[model samples]
Target: METAARTDEEWQEILRSVRRVHFVGIGGSGMSPLAEILHSRGYRLTGSDVNPSDNVDRMTGLGIPVSMRQAADNVGDAELVVYTSAVNPQNPELEEARRRGIPLIERGKLLGLISRHYSNAVGVAGTHGKTTTTSMISQILLEAGQDPTIFIGGRLPLINANGRAGSSDTFICEACEFQDHYLSMTPAVSVILNVDADHLDYFGTLENVVASFHAFAGLASRAVIVNHDDANARRAAEGIPPERLIWYGTGAGLVWSARGCRLEDGSCGAYDLYHNGEFFTSVKLGVPGAHNISNSMAAAAAAHLCGADARQIADGLRDFRGAGRRFEFLGTFGGVTVADDYAHHPTEITATLAAAKGMG
Candidate 1:
């Protein structure tokens, strides 16, 4: 029989054995947070990015040396190398690391390693709303005095950064599904906001996408929280033991559900939250859009699983103005209110535009 793969604890122990670590393309949203975590752990770190960015400046401020170029020399004297998927396979530093036989791992794998350290790791995964839901969970956890270690894809105003190194055992992160990156994580609670056809370039078919999500759900050690209204999400979570699956949606008979939804100025929403067919709390969200109501429901469920009470969930959702770039409001110019959003996918664009149109 073949030897079993190393457990997360084993991988974490192995990571602890290294001192000097090098990161290629470290300024990326995903890479920077992992770097922050490792640096907090006292690992001497060096990194290189092709372009200057706020993330790069942040790393430099933390006393982590970051090179502006990607030459092989930048990999000097590192015991281990970590690179993002965005980095080219032929990048000089990566080539040098391989040539020198330095142990190498991808950014997602590093995130997985870090997550294993937390007893309550909440991995928020889905085709949409990952960032928003993750931010909401972070807000609730923080408000509840959890002080979770959060790694969101977008900047969270609560922390004034995209990531933070918290002293608590709770770890909250946006678990991206692109290229099956989330498969590497073993979450204590895996929250699936929804499932849809996305990243077709990597996953050739919607079926394959669902399959990948199913695989990710299987990695959850405690529970899988899913969107009950989404058929694809329901399908993705089909085989999970009933006791291990928690469903949240607008519909009735869900473990977590929302009712009496009312929108303020056709944007922000207020709803009565129900848990197990009983009233949990009344949630008034700071963020706009009907979609956000669903996102909040999911966030609420995840937070509850992580020990947040009803009051914390409601207050947290109420305090979240929105993650950076998800329907962000820019200052009005010439009486035309300006706004920015990171909505590329058709589904996301539709929801964003609908929210904007509703504002009028």
Candidate 2:
């Protein structure tokens, strides 16, 4: 997707000129948060979703008019039309907006515009763990009294919502790499968890995926935090200078490293965190899985760079139960335990099952 090429002043002017914004496919996870952010910013918002969802109900409860059906008339008096990638090309409401000459922007582009309003826009990008890691960072910042603006892909239990309009200059969100969507935002801190060969339908090859991540990292104006243990993440950070690059993993000589790692009950992990080879703090994760140890380290690195102390990081990680669907415990039936997780990729599935096996 091609984003609008405009300066910060130009985007600000565009936002000022518009009052009423309409969203297509508003119930989507990505679309709902953007709508909520705009609504909180005092923009008159309306939306249409093909199916009723919890998100639709939430938007209606906020007094935003949402139509259950899509029609040309649904674009009534909208000054700007925002559509997600999932919207059909021939949708009536979109066609009506185009016919009426209303300015249109993709959801990612609008997010980019919103990101510019923050001094510290931390974008978490990776093939997996984006939601979980983003939630962890949000928890840390919020617990530290930073009051950061958050836009996670899943529901964060700390705020009891997927997005929050905060009073601080920090904006944290998931920077998705599909179709180069992440290139739209300018992040002060870019956290690349790990790169993997997914999204082949859009990227066509693993090398292309790595290249896209490299470009995304270059967009970070201040710092780039990456996983040193992942080979692909290392490749993505190859050209970055030492001063601007921050490495986190389980090894010596790293800016942020974990040591004395031990797992409890084969799921949860406790580790001693180190910064510049000095003991920073001891962290005990409330969330299950050894993979989450790595996720917590990445989150801790981001929170520390953003002005959080070691105590705040440890407390935040200890308080986080988990994201909405990343290894959620459903219930036990007939002496058999059941749980749910959103692990689709092979790598994610492997990690999730390993944690489950440990619990058993």
Candidate 3:
């Protein structure tokens, strides 16, 4: 059987083939979003994970059955099975699916398949800031009233979850690079936020990581949006033609650049946005950090490429309050504002700390 469906009708037929879907490791962040999306799409979803998690409870509340332990019995009546990358072949549910000859789909491949159903699929990818940038893009699209279906790596306040099912044909998602999973996606527009020396455990080297990113960009059917300041990101997008490539940065010779960027209210940033050496708009970020400004630029560029106007871009960035755990402010007490962030990389930490230090 052909795994990929080239047309929406073909994709619909593929989905119609499976009535009951089973997911292994359904409690995971990556798996949970897909489960939610599939469930919302009218699939009879059943899942099993190693242990119970908040995600399991969430899925259960959604009326999807969730088993606490993974077992072959959990695949009961499932016509199709989906598994995360972390799942091993020895997993009883997976083994059962194979034994029963049920069609199996991996998480990334499933995302790709779902993307094909949409007329416009925007994939945000990078070594870091994938979550933040994806959230930003989602916000811009939402603010523009585009009604984009979004699958973000982080929980966005606007959606109150990691995924939002929209009626429009536009779909936005974070394209993860770990294990080269992003290469599976079929995006109309792809954004490469930045490429750095990370995820070495999987790719083994920066060169391999760049190659993977290049392949990701090559998958874009419409346009590839890349960061002009990041050499690695620029290099990876070299295969795309100049017309197909849209560059955004804070340096000379770029398509989009920020001018007069400065910290505002001790945390946020105020900047003048430029597109192709012409003043586009003045953007004042709701979230802090120059890094966020860059993220907003990328989001703006993507939304613009997809037809969002300047006002929508400005309003979107202004409305965005930042994703969960990324510079998330807990509360303020005794003249001290408590905040939490999930920055792991050194550059991420630096940006987060810099924003925190400037907070009033």
Candidate 4:
């Protein structure tokens, strides 16, 4: 598959035009990354969050001005404003941005625009496994010496480092389907790790979850990988052209399959992988779980499709420790490892428990 470049002249103009920007609700998971990206790109960034968090602390430390309150005064000197969906239109800063006629874009659109700038951008989308899958892909990219910019909804452990300055065109990020932001990404190679019923607050129903993924998969100009093991995922890929869809699962029609896997006896467990009906390699994942095994396959399929070598892919997968708040071992307090995961949804809870049981 050919690499995707931003063809939209308007998007290019936005990136070019953003010099100093103000963020409303800047401490959020989504907003922090946008702030980081813009700041890294030399944008004079100012932001306000209702409360202070580590993310906000990090931004201010980077020299971006931050306000503790969402005052309209925060937007006074800004030429542009960025807001997350969580930022209500009633937000004083947001309203001020509107009154000043400054450009206001959603956090999702900014992230999408950031993704388009990378040549090997892989957007991992699913109702679950997004952070884990993204971390899996990032580990692979890093182990192989591929300097890819990385971002996940949860912080990853292997990267020990949160994000990096990539030397290559590759950038990997989790494309959350909530509020239909996953559709904003221009993915050259995308991975739909799984499709489950989630985000009922926005998507409303299981059918809507599948529908959003369908719309997202349709946005893929190159390859869209799906999980053959997931029925919803299979349905999601139904409309995608056969050539554009890559499936991964147990001995199946998918491009890649785990075939059979047993956790290796080590600090980070391992698995044997298969690609295109052939034994590919013994992939020692830096993370654990049957779900992660599947994520590894998806990452490999996307990386392979995007021109990364098998050896590099294997290294990246091996180096990925785990994502932040994702089964993270918060030091054994009393001979018991308390694993913390940011999983709140039903499916996520099940997977987290399963991963913990597997470790035990």
Against the hidden reference, what TM-scores do the models get?
0.95, 0.96, 0.91, 0.89
User: What's the distance in Å from true for residue 270, model 4?
Assistant: 3.5
Residue pairs clashing in model 3 are: none
lDDT of 3 by residue, 1-360 (tens): 223424536545667787789888888778888888888788899988878766788789899888888888999998888887778878888888878877777788788788887889999999878898889888888877788788887778887777777888888899999888888788999999999889888889999999999999999999999999888998899868888899998886788998898888867988999999999999999998878888888989988977899999999899999898888878889988887899999988998888877874
Q: Please identify model 1 stretches exceeding 4 Å from their true place.
A: 1-13
Clashes by residue pair, model 4: 139-316, 140-316, 140-317, 155-323, 155-324, 156-323, 156-324, 157-322
Candidate 2 Cα misplacement greater than 4 A, ranges: 1-12
Q: What ranking emerges by TM-score with the best candidate at the front? A: 2, 1, 3, 4
Q: TM-score for model 2?
A: 0.96
Question: Considering only N, C-alpha and C atoms within 3 Å, which residue pairs clash in candidate 2?
Answer: none
lDDT of 4 by residue, 203-248 (tens): 8899989988888888877788888889998888887898888888
Please list all clashing residue pairs in model 1, or write none if there are none: none
Cα lDDT of model 4 overall? 0.76
- What TM-score does structure 4 among the candidates reach? 0.89
**Regions of model 4 farther than 4 Å from truth:** 1-15, 158-167, 266-269
Error of 3 at 133 (Å): 1.0
